[model samples]
Target: MTYRAAIVGTGGIAASHIAALRGRSDVTAAAAIDVADDRVHEFARNWEIPRTFTSLTDALASEDIDVIHLCTPPATHLPLAREALAGGVHVLLEKPPALSLAEHHELISAVDSSTATASVIFQHRFGSGATALRQLASTGKLGKPTVTTCDTQWYRDDAYYAVPWHGTWAAEGGGPTMGHGIHQFDLMLSVLGRWEQVSSMTARRTRPVETEDISAAVVRFASGALATVVNSVVSPRQESRLRFDFEFATIELVHLYGYDDSAWTFTPAPGHEELAETWGDLLTGRPSGHAAQFDDYYRALAAGRVPEVSARNALHTLEFAAAIYASAAQNRAVSCTELTSSSAVWRSMNPGRTARAAASA
Candidate 1:
């Protein structure tokens, strides 16, 4: 039986969802929905989607869509996901799942009360290399992780932020730290496990936007591993890289967007030369992208289980992003536990600025 999906928000990222659905015989893109009528119609025509709607409400009422792929902006994720969950339809959200941890927790509650499940798009975790890395790390084949680095240094000019929502805290959330680097660092967290603390700094040096164009953070994982993370849209040299230095070996991946096994290098420590052969045997050549993740999601649905990158799993990544913002805004290290609903940063990423403004008034 084929599952039907609706691609909501016919934007740049919606095409990736459409392509993933098209590649799978067990799933099909049945409809397209967007606030703009012309954009929705054009997207449907371009992708040969069967139906189109100007709103999710009309689409949900009119079509038997099994899942809604929300490629909308950060601000719309919570409400759109709630709407989809209300209809008992599964939801696949683009990353930075919700604007804040509070919003994410609310969505989690919505999922708990609904018959359907909600998942965020962190496709990198489904990559074969990432899978191998996680397994090796979990089983201690890589030995204890000591140090790591995750960097997303890509160039996004002023024109990129010219989009009304691109650099705004209200819409896009928090620039590259939340929007762009999330995919890479989410992959990092997937391999490294729970992060305990974060110390960060954000700056808006180049881009003329409300949000910071570049951000840096030092993260401490539960395993006592320390990681330096850098998310930047102002760098001239574009690269997405992650390096894990374990006791036995130093494994690294360097690629701008997506990577296959070739992009990863497993360098064994002096006495552990044989581990390189193990790495070669374990690495699956499958590349990381939407198609791989969609396949896994469908399989989970078939088995009547929650999918990878489920709301609960995504909450950790979102919390990490929030912690970066909170740490930067508050000018101190932020613990994951401090991000409860009562926290000021729970509602806004730059709560310190708001507090300072209020105090001056």
Candidate 2:
């Protein structure tokens, strides 16, 4: 059956969703909704959407939509996600699903009790290099993956933060750490299995907002692997990459600007023929991007199977994020289990408190 999808935001990232949905014969942009009237009209006209709504409540009340894509900012996700789940519409949530761990848990509970499917947008997981890396790691070709590193040195100028909600703690959650760095963090977690503990530090190097513009973290995985993440929004230019080290092999993934079909170097330490063969097997498939992710989501919806990028899957990533921030705030290593179980920490970071800080800062 064809899926009727409605896009809720018309910002820059929403265009990526629109492009991914364009050619799918199983889905169409049934409607568009945004607070900005011009954005709503322009996107609807450009994408050939037949209808547009001024708000999410009005759109969710309509009976035609089968899938709802939440492309709104970080601060606005939880309430809208809960609303869509209540409306019995499948959700394609954008990155940094919520501001804190408790919100992520609450949203997961909402999705679990509802009949709707909820998935987050970690588009990098669909890229060829990343997909290949995950496959090799899963097959034990990496030989007990011991170390992983992620570098997200991207530039966002003063103009980029000109928007009212761009860099504030209340509206945007955190700086590059949560807004941009979360992507590679999610990808790192995807490849290395699961994080057990994290210690992080965030700084306001360039941006004047209350949230940090630069941050770094050291993560320990459940399997005893070490991982490091470097996130920044004032790097002068954009550069993105990841590298993994194992007992018998090493792999390097380097890309810039955005995800594209790219090549990676798989180096065996020595006398590991099986590891080399495993890498060879992984590289045989064609590269994929946003289109592949959407295709997978659509297929899952059709077969009544849970999507791989489901909200529950994303909650782990969100838990890792909250642990990092809490470690930075408390100046100590934080356990993922503790971070996920404590709801008070998340309550402090909610808009109720963060909103006051943003107003004063």
Candidate 3:
């Protein structure tokens, strides 16, 4: 059975979701929603979407929609998702799910209280190269992970931040660290295992916006691995890549232009012969990354089982994000538990506060 889907935001990122959905075999794009009426018509016309609504409430009222893909800005996700879940629609939400872990919890609670299946989009988990690397890391053959690093060196000009809510704390949440760099950050955590602590630094390198345009962090994992992240929108050319150096092997996945199919290189450590055999299994079809995640979510929904990428699992990523911010602010290492606990600092740093204050000023 084909899942009927509706997109709640029709911006540039929404176009990617529409494209991915259009390419999927078991889903159909049934509707599009955006506050701008002209954008709705343009998107629906260009993508062949059947129904268009300016109001999310109206789209949620449609009985045909089984899944709602929320492509709205980070700050707007919680309320819109709450409304959709209340309307009995499964939700595929975008990253940095909300402004804080508190809001993330509220959304998760709402999903648990309803029948809708909810998940965040971490599509990098779907790449063939990502799968091959993750398999090698998971097995003891790769020995133990030593270091992993991710760099998101993409360029965004003045015009890119010209949109009213582009760089502020409240509207967009954070800058490259939370926005552009998060895909690889999630990937790093997946391969290196859970994070035990994080220390970060953020600065405004290029844009005059309210949020920092660049950020970097060093992380220590529970398994004694070390990792670092560098994110910026100031690079002259665009590049996205993740490299892992393990005790027994080194694997790197490089994506040249945005999020298309990527290329990879794997180098086995001296003593690991058996681990190299897994590359055949990875290339043939093991399904451990993004595609595997998507398949797992679909199967669970069909069989009345809980999704593998559950709200709690999604919360871990958010907690890591919060730790990054907290680490930078406090100028010291921050624990994962400290980041997820009830705290007034994150609520005060909502980033959207600047936008709201700007309106009043």
Candidate 4:
């Protein structure tokens, strides 16, 4: 059965969504929705989408859209997803699924009540290398992750933030930590499992934006593995890197944006040379990107199961991001359990700013 899909928020990312949908045999890119009528029509024309609407409501009302891909800003994710889910349409949201844990919870509640499912786009986890790493780590083949480092060091100049929603806490969420490095760290979390605590620091070094231009964190996982995470938009030399050191082998991935099997390297420790063959066999599939994720999502729908990176599954990564902010703000290590409904970080990732605003008022 071919599912009809509507692409919402026809910005630059919508093109990726459309392309992914087009690549799928069981899905059709039926409609494009955006607030700007001209832009939406242009996007539809460029992508050969048959329908266009100025809003998701109009698209839902007119087109028989089975799923809606929300490629909008961070602040708009929850409401748009709620609307699509309410109409019994599956929702595939862009990264940083919601602005805060509070908003993410609302999305979770909406998904719980509706027949439809919602997934966040953490495309890195769908890669063959990441999948192989996850399987190896889970099956004790990697011999326990000991030390790790995840870094997203990409350069985005001042002009990049000149876009209205590019670097604001209210719109894009929180600079590189929320918008950029999330892909790498989310993939890290996927392979490493639950994170226990986070201690972090954030700074607005160069960019004249409301959010931090860089963030660094020390994360401890439940398995007693220690990891360092760095997110930056100010680096001149750009790279996305993740390295995992296990007792039996050392695995590393170095790439920007997306990764194929070539981006990964596995070094087996002495007496474990056979693990190289296992890694080679496991990492022989598609690259990490929207197309791979969309393929898996459709398969989940066909199997009557929740898709990978579902709203619930994605919450851990979102909470980990929030914990970084909370730790930076409070100047202490933060536990995941601390970000409850009553916590200020739950309402806004930048709780320090919220507190200062309240004090002045």
| lDDT tens digits by residue: candidate 3, 94-163 | 8878777778889889988898877887776666666666676666677788888888888889999998
* Clash count list over all predictions: 0, 0, 10, 0
Poorest 10 consecutive residues of model 4 by lDDT? 16-25
Give the number of the best model, judged by lDDT. 4
CA lDDT of each prediction against the hidden true structure: 0.91, 0.81, 0.77, 0.92
lDDT (Cα, tens digit) per residue for candidate 4, span 248-317 = 9999999999999999999999999999999998876789999989889999998989998899999999
How does candidate 4 fare on TM-score?
A: 0.98
Error of 2 at 247 (Å): 1.2
Per-residue lDDT, model 1, residue 224, is: 98
Q: Give the clashing residue pairs of candidate 2, or none.
A: none
Off by over 4 Å in 4: 356-361
Residue 319's C-alpha lDDT in candidate 4? 95
What C-alpha lDDT does candidate 4 achieve relative to the native structure? 0.92
Ranking by lDDT: 4, 1, 2, 3
TM-score per model over all chains: 0.97, 0.93, 0.90, 0.98
| Runs with alpha carbons beyond 4 Å of true place in candidate 1 | 353-361
Q: After superposing candidate 2, which stretches have Cα over 4 Å from the reference?
A: 284-288, 340-344, 348-361
